[model samples]
Target: MTLKLAIQSIGVVYGDLGTSPLYVMSGIFPDGIKHEDDILGALSLIFYSIVLIGLIKYVFIVLSANDNGDGGTFALYSLICRYAKASLTPNQQAEDKEVSNYRLEVPSRRLRWASAMKSLLENSKAAKYLLLVVTMLGTAMVIGDGILTPCISVLSAVGGIKKAARSLGDDQIMWISVVILIFLFQVQRFGTHKVGYSFAPILSLWFLNIALIGIYNFVKYDSSVIKAVNPLYIVQYFMKNKKEAWISLGGVILCLTGSEALFADLGHFNILSIRLSSCLVVFPSIILTYFGQAAYLRKHAEDVASTFYSSIPKTVYWPTFVIAVMAAIIASQAMISATFAIVKQSLALGCFPTVKVVHTSRKHEGQIYIPEVNTLLMLACVGVTLGFKTTLKLGNAYGIAVIFVFNVTSTFLVIVMVMIWKTNILLIILYVLTIGLTEFMFLSSVLYKFLEGGYVPLVFTAMMVTIMFIWNYGYRKKYEYELENKVSREALVTIMSNTNIHRVPGVALFYTELVHGISPMFTQYVTNVSSLHSIVVFVSIKSLPISKVPLEERFIFRQVEPEESGLYQCVVRYGYRDAKMERQFFEKVLIDRLKDHIQNDVAPATDKQGEPSDHGIAKVNEESVQKVIGVLDEAIKSGGIMYLMGEREVIASSGSGLAKRFVINCLFNWLKRCVRQQEEVFNIPHKRLLKVGITYEV
Candidate 1:
């Protein structure tokens, strides 16, 4: 099973990194190779970058920091948040720690600096916000990569048509790429599982083809290109062409483009599987391909722009081209899928707006389709494809997004090493200087091209960061409002006991974000309508940052008042990767759990003779349980399950600054309007749902 997954990971996890060779050489020498030694320098840099960053840092170190089995920036944040009170969401409770997978390791010896760092993060609001901003920036850049990857990968692959038919114009190739991209995204609705069978085979074939061709080129052209593996060439290349070489780091960074996906997609495969696939299959194939490309470039400098295609043997060019295109599609699909996943995670964590998420596969929880996000990606991808007609410009934008994510991951990884892993401070500093310095160099090169197409990701990231910030801000404020104005148990009793407020004969589920208290929305509803349900369940659907909450631990129930009050608090916990339950199934499960809770509560205590100690008391308890059970069953039979949700309009407090007002009144409000309603998210039937409106000034 592990071997199968490792092979399968080749298509999904390594597609982007594998397809990178199609453009890396071309991107590095866009204007064609200036000096033969420059090829050696470029090769050296690529070799070491893969070894240090890709192999050592990510595959070995970063992968070990995964939150349970999940990876990515959010996963890293979750790790830290789990260890400390750094998360902005106040909803996290002591009960959350009881979750089965919410595991933490205590170091044998705690470092003082680690403790101090955790303290600083927990104590400082600014530090927490900064951490969130950094994570969001990484997430936004990944989304940007989702847009730009397809554009560049497909464009680079399709651009190879010029090598075969020189008569074909650039405009023609661009449109062809646009069409392929459109088609690739169009098939996403079918889910990766539908077409996933072919991805592995195609990608595996691609790697094999590239490896064989690389060896052929090395033997036929110049085998001495193997000497480029020496790190000294990197120094000599830099010393000879300092500024140009520095600038070219932007293109060189592209070699590590899809490396982030390795970590991001960790939830789908185990650490051992990923490590095995990347180290054994991906690394060797890619290194060989780059070396072969450098060898070809050393001899035929003019063909640098189309190095991969130009180097291919004449007999198999068309077949390799076909596989390359397919691999490009696979690569694009992986990133697009990853984007949907992260957005879904963001939504679950309340960092993103509640967009409609379609679970595309029942078997694969990770396979999801967001219509809104998919459409936006399609438009952005098409726009980028047309706007950056040349791979060179697209590479500029692509490199920045990839490297920015790398830098963010590096920052987070360092913190994880210190606080979570409790690694030696000296080793952590070494990691910082080595990986950090390398990424900084790459980041600098990419940022240098900010105006030259790099602004694409920066602009997109700013927009995403703004949306995320506004949504999270509003979400936190509304939660705080609920916390402040939660209806007390006494207040709830008073409302229920009111003579004018008649009790309806239905099971009313008042859906709220509050887990422990009666929602203010419920108070507003009862006050205005002068009615209450005989049985009320305040349902708080909580999404945890982990991948999947265990089924046994899904529903948590607490009685708000005495048994006679018929008010219960049910917290339905879900993990980020867990799909939202259907309304009917969810209600059934809740009712079953409620009955189980009642039965457990009223279970009779036996005497030494194995008889009920208090028969009269047991009878009353049994009758009460039967009565509640009958009411619940009747409600289900008569279709009397009503879902009541709060529709809040958030506004800035009058005492706030102008910016706060604009953010709350304008940006946050507009975002709220754009997202799906709570009723819709819960999949409540229109006839069975009632929305209560409330206003809050934050």
Candidate 2:
């Protein structure tokens, strides 16, 4: 798992991080600082931002608390919930007596948030399917970015012509960007799996290039530019160039393209590895490169040939171009991959509808590429390239998604930590403030690029947000249409009678939708029918996990021993990563301990015919048990109630709605067959079936 995770991180997750070299430096600092001294200030600002926000805040602070082993929004939600439950104020700290008498098990903040998301999904049909669609859209946009990133970054680097041709008319760089887009589109058929290997090395080279350049710049120029280390400089800059500073943030924000991916991909890779890679490996290099670019611009101000290009030495020109181009491609690749990850994650979260998730590679969940998404990305990116000819312009339009992904992640984080974790109020406030400050700073940096051409990312993000709302809304309405409200428990009980009860001795599968508490209706019916049962299996399909919940955690179930009401149970689970509807509890089983002490397992298929509980067949025989209600009758009185209890089956609303529909449909068909056979049976739909006569006042 660790090895697979490592390869995925290197191959996909770091694409944007590696590509930070393309326009980050060029975008942030002023072109006027083409001299050594003033340029140092710009360099100072860039590096400082990377270190403070990128490394310190995001990697160390936020990524560290991955729940147990899970990372991302949901994982953190779990931890925050843990924290919230454990969270205690200084003034209101619990006393030993209070602790001993009433220990509060705070519900998991993460779980509840996930629950709300799930409820929204289960309650709405469109909401259930929306997860698939929105994610696929994001995936397309990401691929589009991949193509544009390389051409822009590399061409900008080799483009010494402007500074060479006296910083004027040169469409060569623009043309190259277009060509790169063409190449990126061309390679789609072959798939990225083969060419992907070259990406990490090229990205590494790009980073090494910038790191070396930054070092040389610092050594040769006024080292005091290092004073930008003080967060005060950022404050001072904002104070002086308030508006400019605010807008420039949008550009700086670009440096963190796949920041959201960290949370999204938390399930795939270990938190420590990602954190270390970002802080120690990725951050320093980016900061240095930005500063170096600033240094070069400072020293060569009169040479407005192109602040983006003048940063590197004349001798290393072509090599630098090659490296930069590769980095851009890698950046675009990272965007593409992250898009895939995001879409996959959203599908699992139940935000979109009907997305087919194909596990293209058995190696890792991150390796998947949706065909629909790939083609769409090719088109969107091409549009971006034609619309904005230069990398500088692209930078402006690039960060809208980052701003949104970041804010969403941060919002979820605080919700989990402060309210969920129940952490110290002062600390929670401080953390929230920190995230807010970083957001403000990054947002400011990009404004310079907005009018310069920042509308593109927003267009994409808005499209996504709109789709999400639609999918969620449609689903809720659908559920409202099918839901059957229940009357009081007393009224329900009055309808049950021993005369109506028909019992059996095999297995009775009762399906239901368990909201927050136990279902009162199901409870009443079970007790009213004086039934004797060998095994009463309560089956639930808890479609909480998303379709994107990497393959490893995709299908998991936990079975509890039989509890009150003589019911054995099993629940199947999903996270925000798994997609597609599946019948049967992904190969899990429930056990019956009371009677024969025989263990019970539910096969995905039909149970074997004529097989006693003692012989646990590998497969389920769906045909024979169109309806089997088990009973352990030893008397005439309870026997009538028990034998007659075989009248109805039970189930839960946790499985895929599509899957649930299929199961109930199958059950109904079985009941019809029994009636056709002339066997004495009770054939009734759960929603339509009712208690005989008890009525209650509201």
Scored by lDDT, the top model is 1
- Native RMSD of candidate 1 (Å): 1.6
After the best TM-score superposition of candidate 2, give how far the Cα of residue 512 lies from its true spot, in angstroms.
12
**What stretches of model 2 exceed 4 Å from their correct place?**
1-11, 29-31, 34-38, 65-172, 185-198, 221-224, 230-242, 303-305, 444-451, 485-542, 546-572, 579-698
| Predicted candidate 1 versus true structure: per-residue lDDT over 1-698, tens digit per residue | 99988988887888899999988987787777788989999999999999999999899999998988999988988788878888887887778779999877768566787899899999999999999999899999999999999999899889888987999988999999999988888888888644654688889999999999988888888899888778999999999999989999998999998999889999888999999999898999999898888888878989888888999999999999999988898889999999998998888878999888888877788889998999999999999988989898889999999999999999999888888788888899999899999999999998999999999999999999999999999999989989999998788777767789887788899889986587789888987888777788999989876778998789988877756777889999998778998778887888889989878876777799989999888788788779878877776666578888887888988899999999899999998888887777677789988889898877
Give the range of the ten consecutive residues with the poorest summed lDDT in model 2: 86-95
* Candidate with maximal TM-score: 1
Those runs of model 1 whose alpha carbons end farther than 4 Å from true positions after fitting are: 606-616
C-alpha TM-score for every candidate = 0.98, 0.63
For candidate 2, lDDT tens digit of each residue in 389-503?
Answer: 6766767666655665455456556555544344555676786677667776565556446566766665665665555544443333333322334334354334333345454
For model 1, what is the alpha-carbon lDDT of residue 236? 96
Per-residue lDDT, model 2, residue 11, is: 50
TM-score for candidate 2, residues paired by index: 0.63
